[model samples]
Target: MSNEFKDILYEVGENAVRITINRPEVFNAFRLQTVEELIVAFQRANEEKSVNTVVLAGAGDKAFCTGGDQKAHLSEDGLYGPRGTVGLPIEELQTAIRDLRKVSIAQVQGFAIGGGNVFATLCDLTIASEKAVFGQVGPKVGSADPGWGTALLARHVGEKKAREIWFRCKKYSAQEACDMGLVNKVVPHDKLAEEVEEWAADINQMSPSAISICKRSFNADSENIRGISFMGVQSVKHYYMSEESKEGVRAFNEKRKPDFKKYV
Candidate 1:
């Protein structure tokens, strides 16, 4: 029922598979190994016949995930690793979740910022705790999601609001996120797990084949965003090498505000 891995925990339950980001010490931020492990876990759930739902969560109550580990990325020469474009296999991970047949749910109990916000958005359903906070920090961090993180997000919360989330980099409460259509439900912090289970259980009762078909049909609409992501990622690769980007990382590491304008 449980599979072991560093950075993350994978477990199979009644008809659902749970993948939890386990590095709460850094607020569950992921590094290269973490994303790689996550992809593998998602693939496992995809191939499992009995699994009807996949739950993505973060360990501890502080954060679901805060996006990529800036500290790790900094140590790796400004890249997450030598795996994918932009130094992380982000596109593949996003594809793995989007292309997954079974319903995927984001069980958010705390902060879901940066790429974590993207994860919550991409999930078929997002159930949040009352204490949850959602937002994007790509631009603020001298990085950006470009593709699914932007285009797909616009589809969820609308262009104006999506721009506010990315450009402003401000946080929103669970109710605010729900009202904006980023989250499906928001419950008390302690009841988050129970609420997610009930939602998963309800989903489990549906016909799997039907669900899969509907999921694909829905995806077909915005599939073009994948191309946008490809182009954007290529641009980001170059951006990462710029002083502007490095400044962001430097400021974060130094616990100071980034003087990005000076680099411009």
Candidate 2:
């Protein structure tokens, strides 16, 4: 019940473990430490005898998570270099997501983009507010790798749609994402938490062991599927630091559309 997490808040209640991203100053952007904290939190929840479900959300009204911290990424070491760098703990986070034994739900409000979308898609179920916007904006920021998104998204929305989102950086509304099978449900902003709680309550009524077994069965089939590759850390860093990526970043910062037309 302590709100002591540096970048997130953790609480246990109603047989559920709730984790809220707390960095509203930058719209809940994920730092290396934040991702590491999430992995530990999820692992702890998995071990707790009293917890049957896990819920993830953001602290503020404006964003569930905007993505990685761009300012951090632009540092001298870049996003994938050495310890305490952006994207390094992402693989660990993904492992935690795949290994979660209990039902996990993402309660999304606004702007679940890039790494945020990756995190949400890691959950077993995604419950979004009608005002939420989901996108793979990493391409606009200079990389196309959505770390955990490569596998989870293709499973939810098909390879074609996933490719479009990743390669083109398309944004989808909550309703659109639900229609496309990205989100499980979309509710009003004011009722999102209530809806999630109601759904969690219903899910918790089922046999936890049975649910866990079924989830394991479903994941087993896709365990070896080609998804995000951590081996490409150097390549991703190179891409982001490339001239094209610089142009993409500049276009985004300048509020103009990127001219990737020529690159294609």
Provide the overall lDDT of each model, using Cα atoms, as 2-decimal numbers: 0.91, 0.79
Q: Which residue runs of candidate 2 sit more than 4 Å off their true CA positions?
A: 84-87, 226-228, 232-234, 241-264
Q: Clash number for every model?
A: 0, 0
lDDT of 2: 0.79
Using alpha carbons, what is the TM-score of model 2?
A: 0.88
Q: Model 2, residue 37: what's the lDDT? A: 84
Q: What TM-scores do the predictions have?
A: 0.98, 0.88
Residue-wise C-alpha lDDT for candidate 2, range 168-205, written one tens digit per residue: 87889999999888899999999999998888788777
lDDT of 1 by residue, 174-261 (tens): 9999999999999999999999888888888999999999999999999999899989999998888788998888888889999999
Q: Cα deviation in Å at residue 60, candidate 1?
A: 0.3
Q: Candidate 1, which segments miss by more than 4 Å at Cα?
A: 75-77
Q: Best-fitting candidate, measured by TM-score?
A: 1
RMSD of 1: 1.1
